[model samples]
Structure formats: structure tokens, C-alpha cells
Target: MNQLNKILVLNAGSSTLKYKLFNATNANKTLALAPMISGMVEIGEVSKVTHKSHGENPKKMELPDANLNDHRSALSLVIDLLCDPGFGGLASKSEINAIGHRVVHGAERFKNATLITKDLMAALEASIPLAPLHNPANILGIEVATELLGDACPQVAVFDTAYHSTMPASAYLYGLPYHLYKDHGVRRYGFHGTSHSFVAKKAAKHLGKPLEECNFITCHLGNGASITAIKNGKSIDTSMGLTPLEGLVMGTRSGDIDPAIPTFLNKQTGMSYAEIDSMLNKKSGLLGLSGDADIRNLQDRFRAGDKHADLTLEVFAHRVRKYIGAYLIQLSPRLDGIIFTGGIGENSWILRNKILKDLEHVGIVVDKSKNEVDLTSQIMSVESSKSQVPLLVVQTDEEKSIAEQTFQVVQG
Candidate 1:
């Protein structure tokens, strides 16, 4: 029998805890999906909780809403399900070797997955201003996990920003004066590093090519989108910067807007600074374009001749195409292919077809029929005799990557 390292991977979002229990040491299958569990919590209304396993139907149990809601109770519930033998828990909590928390912002302090220590938690807290919405919950997860598991069970911080730390000054820096960057640490700090890294490696696997021998433009297009140009095995460039708001058009984000527009809107409309900030972050993007940002619904509307939905899809594709063209120039001679992943990139055949439709001039082409078919392969490439730029759609697994890294870090 082969021994496997069990690492519970936790991706704590604002109101959702998306997790998977993975056997990190299984050479034949490095990661196994946990019974998926998620749903609303102490959010807008009362703190309502809904839970589920990956394969089971969602079951509900209610209690008085926790006044000061946070990740603690959520963590407790998670532990209970894992430890309770009657609940079909995977292991008797003790058998679970470690924890891996998906931390969105590690600032510059963390570049590698570090064992969650008090000192590390302190650093995560200090960097909260950089990612006020995300880092706090990440810190809460660490604190709660440490409290429950104690120092004996190793926990690791898998940072979303760490992989992009390799970006050079020219790629990360803005044209603003040097003092802003030096004094305030105000510069591009890419998010979704884990996803980009996962997709890059996955791309190589699909192409049957050594990662060191290939360079491609990787697009992680979901509601929150980011384009990355991976040179060989490393991240040469990516879309997200400073915060997640600086990239491609998302479900509800104003990506790549004029920096001065916020101030302009505030002055002209007598809107509060907070209001403008919230507007750009919460009420823009495809939502503003199509009257609804949902891809499925919006696509349905487009088929029914809704001009706005069509326009929204066009803008989204245009934004992507522009970036694809830009990255082509950036990696000119080394560009081998264009790869797409993330929610929309993985499932939406129409979007993929639209994005790659006109790229023939750039040696980028796709087999429409192959792309439309569904199959799980490392590489989802089109079978085209004359196609130059190899277009691929790869399914990414950032959580498994985190779990693998967590196991190694704990073992080492």
C-alpha cells in the first residue's frame, strides 16, 4: 500500500469556504476532490448557513445568527465534519496530516509557501491594508486552524501573489514617481498567481512539451479575469495588479479604467470617494455592459437578439484579443501558443471560438469542432493541419497545487 499525505485545502472567500481534501502524496493521483462544501453565510441578511459535499445534495441546519460572524465558526464546522466518524469524515482528524490555506495577498514578505506560524500570521495581518477584503479572512482562517489543530499539525500559507513576485521592475512598476512605490509600496502586485502557475504547468503537460521549452499566453477568464504571458516555466507577465480590480472585464469590476476617472466622477457628481470606489469595484464590467454579467443568461439573451449582451460579449472578447495581441508583441519570437483556462475559458465554446476566430494573421488558429467537444485531457487542442499558433484549453487545479506544496513544506 502507498502512503499518502492528507492535506485539507481551504479557499476562504468573502462568504464561502471552497475546500477539497486531497491525498497529496498519491503519485498516481496527487489530489482527490473533497466532498465540495459551500453556500451563503452571515452575509447580507442574517447569518444563514448552507453546506454540501461534492457528491451529496446540500443539506441545511439552522441556528441563531452569530452576531459577529467570521471564519471561526466556519472552520469549526469544517473540523467537525472531518473529525466526526458518523459524518463520513475522510479521516479521524488526527489522520489528517496538515492544512493549506489559500492566502490572496502575501505582500512581499512571503514568496514561498511557509508553515503557518504566529510570526507569519502577524505579517498577514500587517499587510491587510493591501487586500483589506481578503487578507483579514485569510488571517482568520490561520488563527482558527491553529487554535483547533495546535502546533502539532502543520499548516501552510499558499499565497496568490507570491508567484508573480518574480516580475521585474519594468513589468510591475507604474510611471508614477519613485517615492509612491518606495514609501507606500504602491505598485502592481498580481493576484491569482497560483492559478496562473497551475495553468502554465498544466499547459506544458497537455502539449507534451517540457515547460522549459515552451512560452505561451495564458488567459484565466472567469467573472474575474487575468491574462498572463508565461515564458518557459516562469510567469513573465500577468493581468492582475495591486488589487484584483486592475485586469480584464469581470462580472462586476471596472478593469483597466482611466485612473483619473474616479476623481473626475467624484468631483462632477458630488459622489463620495467611497461611492466611486464601490461603483468601480462592485457595479461595473460586463454587468454594466450587458445588464447582466452571467455568461449563461447573457448568452441566452444574445441568442434572443439582446444587443447589450452581444455588445458585452464583444467588449469582453475585444479586451481579451487586445491583450493577446499585446502579449504576442511582448513575447514575439518565443511565443509558441495561446492557452485559455478559468470558468469561461474552460467551458464556453462560443467564447473560445470568438476569441480565437480572427487570430489567424498571428499564426493563432483553432479547430472549432475539437474545441466544442468536451473531454478531460491535459491539453485540449484543435486538430488542424494548417493552424500555426497552437490554441489549447486546459482545466486548472490551483487547490491541488497548493495541497502538493503544503505537503512538501510540512514534510521538509
Candidate 2:
């Protein structure tokens, strides 16, 4: 029997932790009580945890409004809940044989899931400047897991930028000095690789073709949106640059702005580089365009005769359509279809419809009726009968992908 049958996947943020527990003995199955848990802890906020499991009622707990304080404290609460007789899934922490952590920036070094070693830990620390906001939290998660589970349980680091490591030099390079890329690792290392990779394989399976034989353009449209051009099962090009701030318009992120805008702001407004960076990453995008960052809110306002909302939706759709066209050209000969995933991509038919509009000349079509139907979270077809390129939508499952990858590494 495989000792690494139960796997735990953790995505730790500065103030939050999202986790999923999977029984991987028979194709990555889930526990009956609660398979996923999300917990939030901060200085002056009410700590909250939500649990969702298959074949059971979703449960939520509101902890005391006092400060839960740190990631370690928050993670302890999650472990407590998971081991609780009333809500826990496993009998003990020992049942979990392996843990998979989501590390956001792997630079150019880590191309695949890797076992966490002392040297790997040092490398992750060195790469901290590349992902200041994310890698620290990720490293903290691994440290806490190690402390709690001991050396008996193996820990794996599954990177977000790992899948896009296959991107060719032509696709990943910027028009900058060669020494920048060679010495400082300055290049377009796209984010959301796990999501893009999983959905591309899923798209191939749905089309009844081998993943290696298919081509696809996957748009992971969400708060942090990105588009990827997949050629023969590998990422050839993607929207996100060295950081996730490039690519499509996103919730609060100003994507694809003129490279000179930051300098212009600094020169004109006397804003520091840090201030301009914060504005672009936090104050721009759909939020800057229409005073709201959530797409659902923009969509609701657009339907109710809001002109500003209408324009915001148009700009968002236009950027996505533009990328779709470019990626199509990049993967022209064997172009399969365009896929929509993530929050907005999967739920917002209005956004998806606007994105695919008038692309009939390019062999892309949308079935108006099917496109408008509300889908809770299932993958369904919304392609028109005449479309040479199918429009596909899938709810991206990054945790599931991490769990499967962790199992593979452990089994090997």
C-alpha cells in the first residue's frame, strides 16, 4: 500500500490560508465531511473559516472578533477543525502523509514540482524579492507545516510559474538588455501556470483528443487575469510578464499600461516609485475604470443602463478579444479553440459573449442560447454550430492540480 495516500494542499496568503485535503488512493478522491477550508486572520478583523465538502452541508464558523494574529495561529485553527470530531475529516494529523504548498514565484530555476530541501528553502528565500508579497507567506506555510507534521511527512512545493517555464525565449523575452535576463533573471515568467495547464488538459479530454496533439488559448479571467497560448500541450506564450501585473485588465490591477506611465507619474506628481507601483497594482484596472473591481458588479450595472459600466465592460472585452486574436495568430495552423475559466470566465456569459463577438470571420462562434444559460460550476459547451474554433469554459481547479502533482512526486 502506498503510504502517501492522503495529501494536503495549502495556499497561504499574508492574512489568509486556503487548504484542501484529498484522499489520493483512488484517483484523488475527497473526504466525505469537508474537503476544503478557507480561513482568514488579521489584527482587527473577525476570524472566519468556511468548510465545503462533498455530500455534506457546507459549514461556517465565526471565531471571536479578537485578533487571530498570524498565519501559524490561523493554520492551527484549520488543523483543529480538521481534527475535530464534529467537523474534522481525518482521525489525526498523521493520516496526512504529504503536503503540497503553492509557491507563487519560482523565478527561472524551478521548472517542475520539487521536494522541499534545505537548499531549496534557501533558494526560495533568495527569490523573495521576485515575489515579495507571496513567497514569504508561502515559505511560512511550509515552515509551519514542517513544524506541525515533523520530518516524517514530506512537503512539496508546486509553483505557479512552473508550467509556463516551457515558454520559448521569443515569447518570454522583453526588448531589454540581454544582460538583464542573463544576470538578473529579468524575463516574462507568467503566473497561473497550474490553472492554465490543468484546464488545457481538461479541454483536450472534453474534445476527445490527446492533450499533446491539441492547441488551445486559455484565459484565466479573475481578479488576477491572464491568457496563455498552448501549443501541443505546452505553454508557448502568456499574458503575465515577469510579474502578474501585465496582461489583461483585472479586478484591481492595471494590466498592459504604457511602460512610461510609471515614470510619467513619478515625474509629474512627485510620487515615489513605490507609490506608483501600488497605484498600478491596487488602484487601477476595472476598479479604476468604473469605481468597482468585481466583474459581476460591473455586469449588473451595465445591464441597468449605466454608461460608465457599459464602457468598462467594453474595454475589458476588447483587451481579451485582442489577446485572443494575437494568440490565435501565434498558434494558427493547429488552433483548437479559446477557453474561458476562472471566476469571470466561467460565470459571466455577458463578458464571454462580448469577448467572442464578431470573431466569426476567424472561425469562432458562440451559440447565443447556450451562452446565456446560467451554469453553477460545471463545464459545458457554448459554441455555435458553425464555429471552427470552439468556445470552451471550465471552472479552474488549481488545488486539485497541486494535489495530483504532489501524489505523482510522492509515488515516484
Candidate 3:
């Protein structure tokens, strides 16, 4: 029997640090679907830690007043929780074999999961300009993990933009001056690559084909959404560009707006660039249109006959459908599947119905009954029998993907 190695995956956001601990086979690096330990730390003036441990006897605990001001302190608290008898109760920190971090942007420098090192850390710092809002937090997490866990445990950086790094110049390059891209690295670098890559592999397996032989359009719809056109297992193009704000309409982001809108708002409303940036990134999308950011709340209002809510849903679906159509043409002549994953994509049948409606002419059809079925436990195809292509709802497991990648790097 292959020995099991403990792998910890951490996703550090601006204000939250989410983590999951998996037991993976040391031989093949196959990860267990259910994490042995999963939790998150909410960082602020008064921090909070929510923890869950799974086994024969499951356990859960919440520290509402965790004394953690930042990611470092929060991760220190996590170490304690892991060793505490009542919590994860591991023998010691040495039991953790490897750590995987979800680094949001790797730019063009790091295109694969890499072992964390001083030189790589320097490279990540240099790429910060490409992901100003996310990379710092991710770097902080890596630093803290290294500090607290020490050099005994191997650490790997799983990049979100790495999977999309396969995109050609025509897809990633902007129409701006060549020197801007050549000098300042101004170009599209898609996000949510781990999710898209995870689901695409699963979609290929579902279609009984190797990933390199399959062509797919993957839609990862959540608070932050993006679509990818996958050709022969590589990302040919994706919706998000440079930052995550260039793709589909998101929960709090005004995606795909005119490039001059910021300056226009600056000129018209006397709003500073920072203010306009804040408005677009934090106060737009469903929130901007329907006065709410949560899709469930927006759906509630829509069912209650709210016109603004109706428009919000329509705009969101329209943008997604538009991308689907574009990707269909991009991946023409034997597209194996169209996959929907992430929070909104997996749960919101109404939105899926809206996005897929009238797409039958292109051989895409959603089976209403199958679409409405609960997908919390398993992946399912919601496409009709008459459809030429399969429409799949895949449950994306990015943490597992990270763990698998991390284990591979560590083993090598």
C-alpha cells in the first residue's frame, strides 16, 4: 500500500485565508476528494477562524475572537489548531509533508507549479504589478507558512494564471502599442486557471477521452466569473485579461466596460481614478444593476417581478452566452463539451437556462429537468439527447488540484 502524505493548500485573499489539508498517496500523488481538515481565517481588527475536521468522528469549531491581526498571525493560530487535541490533533507540525499556495498571478514568468524558493519569491514580487490586489496576500501567506512551518516542510506555489499561460499572442495581447506589452508587460493574463483546468480534465474524463484530445469551453461562474476556450488541453483564449476585470459581468465588477470609461467618468463626474476603480471593482455588476450582489437575492427579486433584478440576470446571462457563442466558433469542428462550474454555474439552474436558451441552433441544448437537479454531490450532464455537444456541470476542486500539483513537485 502507498503511504499517505499530508498536503496543506492555502488560498489567501485580501481579507480571508482559506485552507484545506488533504491526505494524498505518496506513490502516485492521487489526492483524496474530501479534505481531512478544511477551514478559513477571516483577518481584521478582530479575526475569526472556522475549522472542520473529517473522519469517523467529525468535528467543527469557530474562534470568533481569534487574536490575529494579519495573515501571519492567522496562520500561527492555524498551527495551534492543527496540533490541538480537540482540533486537527496531529502528532506535530512535522506531520505536514507539503504546503501549496494559490498564487493568483504568475504573469509570464512562472507557467507551472514551482517549488517555493528565494529566487521564485523575488520573481513573484516583480509580478505584483500584474496582480496588485491579490499577489501580495498570496505572498504574505507563503512567507508566513515558511516562517511558521520552517524549512522542513516543502512548499509549492500553484499559479492561477499558469494554466492560461498557453494562450497565444493574438489571444493575450492587447491592441495597444507593441512597446507597452514588450516593455511593461501589458497583456491579458487570465485568472481562475486552476478551476478551469480542473474542470476541463474532469470534462475530458467524462467524455472518455484524453485531455490533450478534447476541446472544450469552460465557464467558471461565481462572484468572479470567466470563460475559457480550451483546445487540445491547452488554454487558447479566456475572457479575463491582465486583471480579473476584463471578462464576464461579475458580482461586484463591471466587466468588459469601455477602456475609456474610467477617464470618461473622471471627466464627467469629477471622480478620481481611484474612486472610479473602486466603483467598478466593488460596486458594479449585479449589485450595480439590481442593488444586490448575491445571485440568490437577485433571483428572489426576479421571481418577485423586480424589473431591475430581471435586467441584472439578463445582462449576466447575455454576457456568458455571448462568450459561449464566441468560443464555439473558436473551438469549431468537434468541440467535445461545454462545462459550467463554480458557485453560480453549479447551483443557478435559472441562470444556466437563460445562458443556454436559443443556443440550440448551434447544437447546444439544456435539459431543463436535468439542469434543475441538485449537483452538490456529483457531476452531471444537463444537455438534451438531441444536442450535438455535451453540457456538463462539473464540481471544481481547485484545492485538490493544488495538493496534487504540490505533491508532484515535492516528490520530484
Candidate 4:
């Protein structure tokens, strides 16, 4: 078996890049981490890099008119940072045993973590239209890392859609004609599979049950969000559809709108399809509703009697509650717990309280005092005595999951 020395996981966005380097050792196909290095790079108009190694203070460096015009430049800078003798993660780029990439859309072709290759890259290129906003950047990150680290360090892809591959046709299919799905592959391929899968296993561990016996509804409520319905460790259904835009209301994407709205807008206002698409994906959601999308900012304003913020919070919580109710019915008597992860889910107790309100009839309750307290990953339970179903807040570590998956592929 190939023992992992160091693994670097990269999540590349349109104009931003984030990476985490793990100090890991693999034995018998299991991987565990030690102290590691992590960082992020902003690649837009103004570029910056934040690098942090274990036991060292995070250092934020402003690149001098940084030429972060592309993923290559950003990755080159990252390699340089990792090699800096002062506080870098490695003395040489060659020390990295493997690199794992977070590819947003794998479609139906890639159902699990895959080792990157020339043929794999060609297949990923065909998946671009499915995730126009994300997969290109993901591929670019992989390409740059491959060029920088060379073929000696194996590269793997941990796809966001892989875990949802188990969803049945009834769950993933849309009402559209069968040909659309058969010919175009236009079906619900959910995003955030990595986070959902990782947290589901974590929740299973926390509940002291084998993952194959646990059922859960995991809420990943970050800027880009999705909720997954897991039955016995497999994703039976998820919120997001063919794209990440189909699920719950997020920071910007408008989720679950009427199907006719796009044509309606085009006919009513003579707007192009592209314009309407951009509006729904970029200008809608909490931002479109109240002009602010960050839950923190909206919550603060909501507390201060801002009616718009109040409505936004109510709408957001309502959507989440709606899904939880549906998933509860879907999972039925076997429903184990409702998991909360991601930014808003983990940090905003007020939102959790709001979501859990009036859910007691369904055996889902939250201890008010317990919910208000500081709960780390080790102490994830927030279940109320009146509740039969547990309310867990698991701090998801997708980077770690990626590294472990990558290790497995490299080991094989």
C-alpha cells in the first residue's frame, strides 16, 4: 500500500482559490491527519494570499500588483508560498505525495473519487456546460497543479456530484420529457456530495451507530448551499438539481422558482434568456429579496427592526423548514436526525432555533439553552428532551474527506 506523506486539496472558484495541505499517513487504506498548512488566494482585481501552517500564525500577504490573471499564476504563487523556508508547508514541491481537486460537476460519468489522467481531463471537458461556473476553474486548478508538481505526485478528483449517484430515477428526474434526460443528461445531479457524505458519516459516528444503519438529512447552509436526504448512508435525494441552482435559497441563487418564470420575464420585458439566467443565478435569492445575502448581516438588521431583513430571514428559514418536513416524510419511521453544517447552519443558533420552531409535532426539538451554547464538533448534539429526533451540528471537513479519498485512489 502507498503511504501518504502529504496531500494538498484545492477548491478553485472563478476568481478565488483555496487550498489545504494535510500532513497525513495512510495504513491499511485508512488516513489520518497531523498538523498541516492551509491558505486562500483572491484572483480578481485585487489579489491577496493568506497562508497558515500548523502552530504558526496565519500570514496575509498583499501581492505587489499581483498577476493573478489566471489559475496558473495563483498556483505558482501557492507553490512559492509552500516552499518559503520561513513558514512554508514544504521544503520542496516534490514532497507532495498527492493532490486532490474539488470538481463541482462530474455528471453521470464520474460516480466516485477518480485519479486524474489525460483521458479524465477530456471527459471533464465535456462536463463544462453542466457546471459552467465551477468545473472550468476546477480543471484549471488540476492542470496548474499537475504542471507544477509533475506526474510523480498523483492527482485525484473528488467530485461534488459523486455521492448523489445513488439517487433513484424517481428522485433525480424532472417532469420534463424523457428525451431531455436520455439525450441531454438533464437530470438532478446534486452538488456538495462531499460535504453531505462526510457529515453523514460523522453524524453516524456521533450517534454511535454503523453508517449503513443510520439515516439523516444533512443541511449544508453556506453561501452556496444544499440539503441531502441520506437513507442508510446513501443519498436517496438532495435539494440541488441538474445545477446548484435548484435547491434551497442561497446567498444569490434563487431556488425552486416557477418553471415558466424565465419565459414570462422574457415575454413581459423582452429580456434575453441569458439575461434572465444571470438574474436568477446571480441577482436573486436573499440578495435580490433584501439587497443583502450574508445571514450575519441580515440577522443583525433583522434584530434592529429592519423589515426587509426580517422577511428575508423568515423566507430563508421557511424554505429550510419546508425541506426538512418533506425529507422527514420521505425517510418516515427510519429518520434518525437532522444535521446542520456549513456557515449559517453551524454558527447561527438563532436560525437553527427558528427552523426548529413548531417542529416538535414531528419529534424534532432543540434545547434552547443548549442551542445557544458553544458546541464544537466533538459536542455536536443539540437535541431537546421533548424531541425524539436529534438535532446535530457537525463541522464539516470536506478537505479532509478529499484527502482521504485521494489517498485511496493513490493507494490503489
Candidate 5:
């Protein structure tokens, strides 16, 4: 029997930890679409753990009474579940050859998947200020995994900002003092790079061209959204700046606002800086506009003739459309394709149609029939026959991308 290397991918959010276990080999072939085992642990007062195994007879179970109050306990429970005879794919934790973590901010130092060493951990710790909400959880996952899995099992840090490292100074720099960028790294470090890079590769494959030869615009429109202009498979520009809150209008995030709005609000409402920040990041966006953050609910409201929902949906579409127009100009003349991925981007055909409505004059014509389809698990071209550039919906797999990079780093 051929030996298979077990690679575990971990994405630790502020209050949740998600994991996937893939059986990999050093062969030049495609990895499996689904993982052998996948699970998530929600950490809180009443913690819970859910596990699922994929195969001929897939099984899923939930432990609502899990005693996981922190990331360490959460990950330890994940290890236990992975070794549980009936629910796990591994015989023991030692079978895990390498671990991959989704580190949110790599700053300017890491441009690719890096093998996690003591120095790398320190570097990641240094970047915590750049991603206060995300990096701590990611670092906690790495630390706990290292303590549990020991030094024998290699680990890799797959950064969310690595792919955007290819962005030029013209795109990344803010108009602030040059010293801010030189000393503090205060510039546009785009997020969702893993999804963008993964979908861009898929789109390039669908176009029958090498990624390096393709110039395209990729939109990753999830709860946290960002759009990128890819020139020759490299990110030349992106919407998100410095943080995930600067891009397209998202679930709860106020995408782009006047720079002085916060200060003005502080003066007017006497709210603290932290309070204003929380309101912008948590109380704004669709929720602030329409009183609801979920797009499906907002779509239903829009269909039911709610004027507020209508306006909110229009506002959301307008921002996305504006970015598409800007990126189109950035990759003009030789633009190959435009891609849509993420939850809302993949399923919300209404928003897609709204964004593409009057873009035909710019060669972006969407086929109504092709635009409306179930694209959750497959790739489809929604561009009309008359459209100059192909419009594709490519489902993103960041975990798979992380696993692949982790395997490569371990092999080397």
C-alpha cells in the first residue's frame, strides 16, 4: 500500500476553530475535492464541536457539551475527535505529517507559505498589531498545535496577505506620510488572498491559459469582501486597504466611508474611538442600511417591495460595480476574464445581474439564463455570446490551497 501524508488545515477565528484533514501524496496530480475529515469548534460559555467524515458512507456528529472555553481546549478537542475510532480518519495524532494555519497578516516579510519556526512565530507575533482581530487567534492555534503535536510534525503558515505582496507601491501606498509605511507598515495589505489566488488559478485553467499570461479581475464577495486586479497571475491592486474593513460593503462592515466620519461621529455623538470603530465594523454595512445583514433575507425583502431593502441592495451592488469598472480600466485591452466567488458572489444572481446591468457598453454582458444557476460546487461562464470577456463563477477552496502549500513546504 502506498503511504499517504495526512495534512491538517486549521483556520482559527476569534471564537471558532475550523479544521480539515486531507490525505496527500507527493504525486503530480489533483488533491481530493473533499477532505477525509472536517470539523468546527465553537468556543464560548457553552462550547460545541461538530465533526464530519467524507467517504462512501459519510457521517456527521455534534458535541454540544464540549468543554472548550478557549482555542487550546478547542484544538485539543479537535485532536481527540480526529483520533476517535468511529468518527476519525486517523489512527492517532502522530499520523499528521504537517499542519497548515491560516495566518491573517504576514505583513511585508512573508510572501509565500512559510515553515513555522521559532523566528517565524516571533515574526507572526510582531504582525499582531496589523491584524488585531485575527492574528491572535491564528497564533493561538499555532502555539497550541505545536505544544500538542510536538516538534516532529512540521507546521506551515499560509498567510492571507501573501498573494497581494505582488502589488506594486502605486497600489499599496496610502497618501499618508512615507514614514508611516516605512516605519509602521500602514498601507493597503489586501485580505482574502488565498481565495483570490485559488479562484484565479481555476479561472485561468477554465480559460485554457497559464495564470501568468492571464489578466483578470477577481471578486471575493463574502461577509468580508474584496476585489482584486490580477495582471499576469499577480495581484496588481485590490479593494481592501490596510484591513478587511476598507473594501466592498460587507455583511456588517462599512466598506468605504469618509476618512473624517469617525472623528465627526466622535464630536457629534461623543463616542469613544473604540466604540466608533466597533460601530463601523459591526453595526454598519447591510445591517446598518437595511436592519439586516444576511443577503438572502435582504433579497427576499427587496422582492417583497421593501424600499429600504431595495436601496440597500442597490448600494451594495453599486460599490461592487464601481470596483469592477475601476479594475476593468486597470486591466484594459488585454483583460482575459472576470471571476466571482464567495458566498454571496456565487449564489446571489440578483446582485450579479444588478452589478452587470449597464456594463454592456464596456463589453461585460451577462446571459440571464447562464447567470442564474446553482454554482455552489461547479464553475460556470455567465457571459453572453456578445460579451468580450468571459465571466466565470469559480468556487474557492482556501483549505485545499493551504493544504497543498503545506504539503509542498513539508516535502521540501
Candidate 6:
């Protein structure tokens, strides 16, 4: 075992493979924090491969269109480009000591990142129904990497649901049929584990407090949104349920509605289950709420007095506020502060104003001047009190977490 530093982190979606290779040496040794080399290869109805080395702008990898048949080929091309020196590629395949994967769901089976093995892969594949769209791609990437790297280089699986595995039964269970709940493993296992975990840790760092002593709520808002109740470094509860489709109104997914919706719509439109699922998962959410899914579009429509757009934003903000207050009440007196991360949470000050506005009665206030500060900086706080609960805006780095876990596994 040598001084482990470089780590390759892979984040695979249904049709996109995004990656970042990080160099993490002993923090005390050198000041040159290794650069992040990243890119995404999108392979779906339309195919495109892109790569960016050392945080530079991505170069279009002109891969042979016909040869790139499936996910496997996509992975192969990615490896080649990462090794290509003409581009920002790391210039050597051997630079990656270990690979860490972003696995979407692990149910209750995994509480932390585990080294990927044949048995673990099978278990991950079995959990596919719980994450029909995400886990398969992640698993595919692991297999492809293992085939190319072999057992000599360890690979790790970091579950998105792992952080929320600490949720108490009261928060995770639903009053559905007992058999369905027991048989299908259909219970609320929240997603966005790594993002929430990263920001929560980031909050602790910014607050200059021991991570184990911090209690906070972290909202990861983006196209996919979720709020996590972090009590002393563990996820006690979260907004997302058994699936990512259950919580916040995402860019293109319906979060929640009446349980009888499918039956009612079936009778009305005679749509099949798959068709309805697609509509709810793909065609709904902000897109369904307003006329379009783009937040800018929503903003434009709202300014133009589009009722639905305004209403949609209201519903979105309302849900976030509800969760904040709910967690406040649930966690009570021990609550320290709230943290925000992810795309919308970190960048959208308007959203911060909407969620944090008028919360003075609950001892929450925002100094508009501080709120308007540049988002690129961390530790964003609006209100300051002598013993004030901190409202922090942290930019999350889940890839670093993945690499750290991968390093541990490889070292072991």
C-alpha cells in the first residue's frame, strides 16, 4: 500500500456517464490540490461523447458513431480519452488507482460505500426495480471498469440511499398494505445521500464545529431536489421516499399526488400503467405544473403573469418551507441551523429569499445584503446573531466523497 492520492469517480445516469478524476494527497504535504478531470458521455436516442481534463472546457470526442453501440462501448471510449494526452486526458490509464461509483439505491443492505465485488454487484442488480433507471447504468460502469482494470485495482460502490438508511421507522413507513410493504420492500428510502452528506459535513466545517455535534437540515435543490434532516452527522429523515419520484417537484417528475391518481386516470384516459408511469416520471413536475420545465422559462412566465408558472413556483417553495418547518418541529430545540446546496439551492438567491423570507417568527431572518452576496463563495449567511443559528450555503462535492471511500476500500 503506497501513499494513495489519485481517485477516479464515476457518476452514471440512464443515458449519461459523468466522471471526475481527483488527486488527493496528504493535506499537509503539498499546497497544490489536484485538479479535477471530468466529462460526460451521453448515449441514448442521440449519442455524443465529451471529455474535459483538469477542469478545462470539454473536447468533443469524435468517437465512431456506429462502433459506439451500447453502454460498454461508451465506457471503453471514455477510458481511451482519459488516457489520451493530446487532450486534457490524464495522459495515462495507470493514473487511476481506484474507481468509485455513484450507486443510486442500496435499500437497507448498504449503510456506507463498499468495495465492489461479484456478490455485491448481483445484490445491486437485484435492487434494480427500486431504481430501474439509475442502478443499471452504475452497475454497467462498474463491470466495464473491472474488466479493464482487473482485481488489482479496487473499485467501490457508493450508494445514494446509504446516508438516509438511518431514518427511523416512523419516518420511512407508509400506511399502505402490510403485505405490499413487507413483500416488495416498498418503504421510504431517500435518495441524494452523497449530496446531503457532503453539504452537511461542509456545514460543520464552515461552522467550525465537530461534525458529530452538528444538527442541521440540508436542502439539495436542482432539477432533482431533496431536503435531508441531518442530526449529528447522520440522516435521520429526508423528503424523498421509496423512490426519487416521491418528494420535491423535480424538473420532469411528479413528486406526489393522490394515491388513487392512476386508477382515476386509467378510467378517464384508458392509459396503460407504463404509459402513465412515463407521464408521471418524464412529462410531469415543473413541466407539468407550468407549461415548460426550464426554471428560466418559469421565471419568464411568472414575470409575464402566467398564473400556472407563479403557482408552480409557489407550490415548489411551499413544499420546501413545509419540510424545513416540519424538520424544525420534529428535531426541536436542538436544531442548530439549515444548509443549502446543489444547483438551485446554492445558486438561486431568489429561492433562498422565498424559503427563508418571513421566517423571523421562527427565529429565521436573512440580511438581504448578505443574501445577495456572490454564491461562488461558501458559508453564505444572511442573518447574524451572537448565538445565531447559521444559515449556510455550501457547494457540495460528492465526487470527493466517492473518491475518499474508494481510497479506503482500495487501501483495505
* Superposition error at 407 for model 4 (Å): 0.4
Q: Which tens-of-lDDT digit does each residue in 145-243 have in candidate 4?
A: 888888888999999999999999999999999999999899999999999998899889888999999989999998888899999889999999999
Enumerate residue pairs that collide in model 4. Answer: none
Give the residue spans of candidate 5 off by over 4 A: 1-3, 28-34
Report the lDDT of model 3 for residue 202: 91
Candidate 6 or 3, higher lDDT: 3
Error of 4 at 32 (Å): 0.9
Error of 2 at 23 (Å): 1.5
lDDT of each residue in 1-412, candidate 2, tens digit only:
2733678889988877888887665435532222444444442265665654443565666555645677777777777777777666778888888889999999999999998999999999999988888999999999988888898998899999999999999999999999999988889999999999989988898999999988999999999999999999999999999888998999989899889998898999999999998988999999999999988888889899999999999999999988988998999786887889998998899998899889888888899898997776547789999989878888788988898888777766
Task: Name the weakest run of 10 consecutive residues (lDDT summed) in model 6.
Answer: 26-35
* TM per candidate: 0.90, 0.95, 0.97, 0.96, 0.97, 0.92
Where's the lowest-lDDT run of ten residues in candidate 1? 35-44
Per-prediction RMSD in angstroms? 3.2, 2.4, 1.6, 1.6, 1.6, 2.6
**Per-model lDDT:** 0.77, 0.85, 0.90, 0.88, 0.91, 0.80
**Number of backbone collisions per candidate:** 4, 0, 2, 0, 0, 1
> What are the per-residue Cα lDDT tens digits for candidate 3 across 1-412?
1367788899999899999988776445444545788899999987888999988898999989987788888888887788888888477888888999999999888899999999999999999988899999999999989999998788999999999989999899999999999999999999999999999999888889999999999999999999999999999999999899888999999999989889888999999999998999999988888789999998898899988888889999999989988998899887899999999999999899999898778888889989987796648999999999999999999999998888778878
The residue-by-residue lDDT of candidate 1 on 243-352, one tens digit each, is 99997889999899888998898889999999988888888998887678789898898889988788888888888888888888888687777888888888888788
Error of 3 at 347 (Å): 0.7
lDDT of 3: 0.90
What is candidate 1's TM-score against the reference?
0.90
TM-score of 5: 0.97
